[model samples]
Target: MNTNAEGHLARQQRVGTLIDLFAATVEEHGARPAVSDESVTLTYAELWAKTEQVASGLRAFGVGQGDRVAIHLERGVDLLVAVLAVVRTGSAYVAIDVGYPEQRRVHMVHSARATVVVTDTAAQDSPWDEKLVTTTVGDLTEATADATPVVAPVAAADPASILFTSGTTGRPKGVELTHGGLVNFATNAALPRILPTDRMGQVSSVSFDAFHYELWCAIAAGAEVVVMPSVPELLGRDPRRELKRRGITTMLMPSMAVNHLAKEDRDAFAALRVLCTGGDVILPQACREILDGQFSGEFYNLYGPTEGTTACTAHRVTADLDAAQPVPIGVPLDGCRVHLLDADLQPVPAGGTGQIFIGGAGVARGYLDEPAETAARFVDIPCGSSWGRLYATGDLGRLRPDGLLEFLGRSDQQGKIRGYRVEPFELERTLRNCPLVEDAAVLVHGEGDGKQLAAFVELAEDGAPAAVRAYLSERLPDFLVPATLIKIEQIPATANGKRDNEALREILRDDLHRRERYQKPDSRTERYLADLFEELLGVEQVGTHDDFFALGGHSLLAFRMHRRITRDFGSGLQLQDVIRHSRLADLANALDADPTGRPIRA
Candidate 1:
């Protein structure tokens, strides 16, 4: 083993500390390919030269130390070059995930108050960039008047990048990472295991902090980074064939990878060497699947947040997890420390659950420009002898008897249901264990006075909503039972692969409205009204007009009503027909006029 203390000491250095590594790669692997995607391949020397040119171009635009630059581009060579260029100019790059909604994109840009926004011509049309200084990839790559490279002085503590994280409480917060912090993290967590002989798969978007590890880990170690293009099919398609095609030896992501493995031919990924995953709790079943699958690779679980660089705790998944209750996050990376503390920041007893606190070079500079928020998260290390502070991960976990870290759910996600603290993840875990459910998400709805649990689930080949409801009723307590159960083809996810709770909440809100739209009927008119409500609302039960929105019925639902009436009942209902006839009884007259014998109008 190479015994060098340089990697450990480098964590305290400033952001520009890795400039030498980039320069050295160009000289040593000048002709060797560095980044390869379907459209282009760039050698280390070529990439270095282009990065220098882009940096020079950026400097001409006055980007310098402490300046924040934004890159709103797709996953491509140009995007990589832009990131490197900003770093080379001694400014941190704020990656804007192209998939971000206009509002979130604007929030990130304005929050950063970026000096310049680097994007392509296609992105300039987006309304979000209207007020920012925009630069195109075409302009940066185009030949310009001769300009000298501008070098800015950088310290290890200086901010190198700002990663925006979508927190559950509010809008996204920017996590500031120093150059030394990232370099140290990459060295300790990635370099020791990866080598130049490895062909690594880069799957996460550049906007995510995980991509930072993917890109730099390869470049710093002289390994080849295979850039996978972002395609709709690739997002939901099997990656096994692609992984094998590129000879991809390593990849890292959350448990979602299990979904991909389930769909692909098992033999396709037989060549994979190392598979690292994290972001959320990995199910025990998923762990068993990987072990029994085609890839004979070492699997590692990395745990941390954008605020703690890439990751602080790691657990190498061995065969033991196949029989364990929950896998531990393992020991801390070199130069880092992990602590499980109670509400008072006091160390908790071994085997007792507590908040996980991380301290070391991995901890970031906190949310950018949000002083109060920064102070709240970056608390002083009360139990450690560290020179710096510790970051309260907001994640609830505990230390195992073996000193390994076992992650519980988020502290904030813990909510009271019927006077008992209920963790949504716990319910979700139970739902998933039924073997009939493919995936499940539980959300606590309502406020202050009346809170209830709602569950949305996607079933396996052998399950249905009714069966799942019955199964949960038998396995869980009455308080833990969901008020509403929805069955979807698949659960939508945020760009980072986490369950989109907001979206699910909207679905539940709609379901509630649908339930109240139509009441039971005592007469033929009322029965017809209930049938109309069911057909119009696309739900089995409806009680009243006040509940239309809760049933997932929107303005588009109005259009369906208009079409149904026009076709079956002779009434030529317009778009406004549904709005005026919000109640089932009010709409029943229109259906009566257009009776079943009438020919449907266009």
Candidate 2:
């Protein structure tokens, strides 16, 4: 840790894998704190020693190089140890988010064909127990008590991790990443902003690619990576206040999270020295607000795919961000190449939108067990230099005249919601899998700035939309679940046997503008709620059945709506109610029940 940037670079140059770089950090500063959660802190030496023991135990348990080891633990010291142990064994780790349903976890683990699952004590009896070996983090000490410390031989090209993301075919695909790509990202992109003494919050969900950026880069810098006590709550006392309490200096938040924070916590936000954000497009208004706030931190807009080892491009947001124009995604990382290509793979001129193609050391080895998809997406660029295969990002963006790149929109059906990449086919396929569902069409609906998932479902038998939503909730992650559900007579189709795009749009438009459901104020409470919902959602009329999120209401709007409800009616509507009870009917009932507007949490 005493080494300067030059010496740190030299050490990293000698290492081939992330584990090796971590080992170098441990050797240089064994006593410095490397990782911590609310309850415990582990120094670099302690982490390395524990990881070696766990690696030895893994070897004793028949874990070998390149084997897939599923880490299903929560965000804590044990989770970090499991990840390091897998790396120390030269095995690619598969991260399973703690809150994911068993079905989703099963699908991901089966897809990766993971040989072992390291989880907490409660998850020892998962459905995959018969197919794979299971171990609890609590038992790692005992299991490795008799085993000797050892670091397995690792190579630069060996598979380092397998991150599962949404697939068009309804199943999640495992994106295979290599040690080289991981190291390249840390060296070229992350190191410039993070330093040895910098403390960054580990705020990203474990399954997300951003988590990798937050974890590995901090380890490379010998910086403390504190586990956020809450998920994506920028104004919370547990995580946000905890970060400030611990004097955390840096963090990489998603754009949505930053946007929400900008609205309320100007004083709290100005505390950091480095803040990097990007997942979907950042609203210029939000960016300008944050930049013009109390925070003087370096704010960056990063863009990339899981296939590009986290981020391939980054731009430091300047004070010139205007509401009329988009914040640029910026230039490529050092040693990375960005190609904005047309349909024919020809380079598009500057200021012309094209499919983003990344070619460089950061390009991953494509999806696992899907050779056709791999070949289709990761194609060889005809005019590429020694960069090799180019990863088709399937995102449209243009190179600005100033050498920066501005993101447009997705060229495919995939879209991002709350920073998680989602595909409608995945939700539609899950809907069709339901026993009563005969036909379904999942669409991304909304205009200007954001989108939300909607499902127009036709069931064989009489079914409730709420029931269908609940069933889907058991299989899909919360972010992938559609905020709106529409029951239909049948899925409209054209002569070509495909979905009738025009008809579907008409259906959506009619639902939005359905004048039949519109009624005058029935009561004082109803009038108040209707006016509030209409104003917050920017809709003309509000029906009791009209959903808030379906009409383009997001977390930010929900917060604003809740604030007004409290001030106007003297009813302290909780934030949870606004987000969860999005229906006017449900909220109206809640409001009527409590004069204070306080929900009972039933």
Candidate 3:
């Protein structure tokens, strides 16, 4: 990045605050569509009215400038309203997932030091009331119906939101973001070429940092916001119906979902003009499928961490990109400089991998309340200003000769499962609480296609697999739950007595390969399923009990398998169900029984 470009990009930060930016949009596109979901469509004017109404109630409830407010609700219009309302009060908002374990939720409420909580009826009985003053959307609306509204005085540097992510330690860490960093993203990086008529799909969780990009980037750019129906909707379901129904012109999705749409529902994304994917590295297969004249939309790859306040790099795919080479994370976002530095803070040679250091205004303030950890990650690099800092992304990458950064892999135990960041340490702590688990160790099981969490447990007594899975399901989000659980007398240790993660991974891999010889398909239906799995997974042989996902079948390939099964077997199976019944035997049984709606497990 040149000095001129740096200054130019840095100057792109123009907005005073996110509220003011969106207010300007509301003024310009008043009658145009703003945000919508399955239930309601709010024009820019209507959304502004609701935001003001909620902001007044928030103020009355004692939320003010510099105070942190927690929004505990699932994704919906009410959720978005509560968020904007909190920011409008000159206070930063924390998006708390309603599904988080009560223990996690309470920890966040106390840790964040939230002054007030805005929740819907779903969280009416939650512990939010015990810690802070709590208000509901309905109550806020009714209370402010007759009251005059006022916008609280806010500065551009004021913190806008706090998002909690898996920390290295057992406790979750809150990443506090400011309006300035967010404004930089929405203005210079996200949807830079966005048109007012373009519709942005909201698929990221309200709690995820990417939600800032999903919602704010569009509204700030004078575009419509289309929220996905639910988390399940964002999963491997047929996107054609939803895309057509919402008239979604743009969507920022995880790579696997993008791959699924292209491979299975090829025509589903016709309504989209721009499709952005990040979270995890996208496979070249996904890009090839989209670029092969299947989908006519532009496919963009976005890259950044919560520390960067959403994506700081974007690359538009081209047909000539090599499938064998690692997909580059693309060039740096405006105002952000990505440096490949060696261990001694020296720049690595071209094509040499190094720790990616992101510098600029895009870097976040730091982790909420964890100054030591924050300081350790955000190093004091030489910049022109007094605040010379850079976020040392633990991720390793290399600058290609073409100037694109190719992501290597993580240098630590933390890994991305599906699209969510999973910290092995945090997951292990959660597992220890389970009565079924007397001792536990979590390790990233595979790389690339088969990447997943594998938990090795030492049981107090014998424990049923389903019983343990059910318990973990209640306590952790679906993504955090280990895909495979193995029982052992004791976890393997190194010579120094520390747990050996490599040893555990080897144990799982050996066990997986040592399973009883592949059971051949007997019946015609079984043979048909086996043949399809072989074709989809590119495996020479597929056993009936073989887990589809474990056999390198991702949701994208699973959707392809689902389509093939439904077409050949006269079934209406869903890709979601196909993932649940992962093995050939289970899927065959599901197809033989009820292939319409959600299939019942045998």
Candidate 4:
């Protein structure tokens, strides 16, 4: 056989589909622990048995090939079982995060045409449609079937899952991922090697693409999957204690989390054998700190979008890497291709910047039920000897002299906030539809972790900023909601009728000056917090009552502050405390009220 043919045959024999690879892993590692959360741990054999039972239950309920099952359970062993069960029944799973707004969940289910939703028992009374089959994880686990359900033949190209991403139309688009794409990614050699003895922490939300990285990649290599605690628990808890307690050897954390650990506990990742992070820009200083510390693990900076699987490229951060510039995105994975092309779809000249396009086995099938969008993004391009499809990432990047890919910002209005894709048009449309708003425009402000969504609203006569914010909070996810909502007489427009973002920024500057008045810190607690706020927000002379959000503080920054408070103040303040009591004075008061009367750090 030729080289390509042999590789194809080898892949088919080993992992024709994700299910096949998983089954093989189960057979080899049956006695070993496969996955565990705080509630339960399951060996590979036990996990397979549970998955079989759920698959049988699904088959009995008339779910079969081509069906899409919505999995809305929280992060746990049950969630993993439901996903495997759905795939085993020859159906695709649609992930619906439990924390999503009710309206958003409804839209996702309706858009994906999911007739069945599997949720936790506690969520049985949720507002799912009466006509849909709404079953709980408990029901599936306890279900009895007369005979074992036969496994359906799964094709490599068949859809494995549909992930919802922010869309310009104000509704999320379901990006269909194929079984082949996932299998290719899980087994690809270009990724950081996951050892069988490694215990990888599953931190990403089920709806997030990184969940695949945390679960599939670990399980495929016969590694133990350790699901971390919820967002609240993680933020308040010390990083060094938790990772050590869990015996976590590998973790794919977000860049924000990595940076926080680097700042607070440089040796937090000492127990980890492989530490990989991505989703946002990796700060050079943060990487340097970790590398310089007691962390003896392999550290990598990953980069990719949902359209190109979880991660397309990874750059290992060594002690010798240049600390002057942002780390390169590195080269494509074994089964993937990265192309930097100009407007005409031709490759950019050497060392020139162009839009990044991803092509290969990991490229998604495209948006479900949206042919126009699929055609627009997933286009046929000339490969070496044949025509192949490539997803136009809309992200700008350039090839370095060493052939490594360096990332630039987006080529379009879309931006990434806390690793989630943010479409300004989507936020603007939601704002315009608000009952309190007459007109609205949304723009991204600041850079990196300080980046936040700012909405300029020309409100109706009876509308108020507070009421408008509440309206948006009710409709959109916390990440999607604007951090700053400014009342404007009208949204500025250019002479050519385009939204004049420059003019809007000038108005924002004037508004900031009008609202903010410097008041020096009075107490020791207040002064300490003021210093942190100034350092985090990249501003000086912070007023005691100045709003954190108005000063460009975002969720990531808030998380970092939460960690710092717990460590420095010896308080039990939760992540919500930092956000709810955003003012410097308010936060100081909360910290003072903490029952733990340990003195603040020097």
| Best candidate according to TM-score | 4
**Candidate 1 per-residue lDDT over residues 1-602, each given as its tens digit:** 01234655553342236575576667777888888787888888888878878888888788889999999988777888888888888999999877655655777888988979998787777765565678876687564335565576877687888888644323467889987778777667433387777777887767666787788778776777887844223433335667777788877664444323433333435677887776656666667766777667788888887788888878888766744587677778777777888988878887888888888777898888888888888988658444448898777887776777788866887554433345677678778888889888888776421456788989898888778877776655444667677888889899999888889988877866655554465445446555665765455765434334334344334444554555455555555655676666566555555445353333
**Model 4: C-alpha RMSD to truth?**
2.6
TM accuracy, model 1 = 0.69
Report the C-alpha displacement of residue 570, candidate 4, in angstroms. 4.4
Give the better candidate number (2 or 4) by lDDT: 4
lDDT of 4 by residue, 141-167 (tens): 677434475588899999999999886
User: What is the model-wide C-alpha lDDT for candidate 2?
Assistant: 0.79
Query: Pairs clashing in candidate 3?
Result: none
- Mind giving the per-residue lDDT tens digits that candidate 2 earns over 1-602? 01124543454468779878888889987888988988999999999888888888778778989799999988888899899889889899999997888899988888899998998888888788496889876576677876776757788788989999886766799999998888877766433568878887887888989988888888877888888754434332323466678788888887776765665554455668888888877878888787777778788889999999999888888787766888888888765778889999988876888999987778899899999989999998775444357999999998777877888889998988878889999898899899868889988877434577878999767777878888987888877888667788988999999889679878877776664476565656766777788776667778777677766676656766776667565775577866788878788877887766543221
- What's the TM for model 2? 0.91
Cα deviation at 220, candidate 4, in Å, is: 1.0
Against the correct fold, how does model 3 do in TM-score? Answer: 0.91
Candidate 4 segments exceeding 4 Å error: 1-9, 383-385, 566-576, 592-602
| Candidate ranking (lDDT, best to worst) | 4, 2, 3, 1
lDDT of each: 0.70, 0.79, 0.78, 0.84
Of models 1 and 2, which has the larger TM-score?
2
Ranking by TM-score: 4, 2, 3, 1
Q: How far is candidate 3 from the true structure (C-alpha RMSD, Å)?
A: 3.5
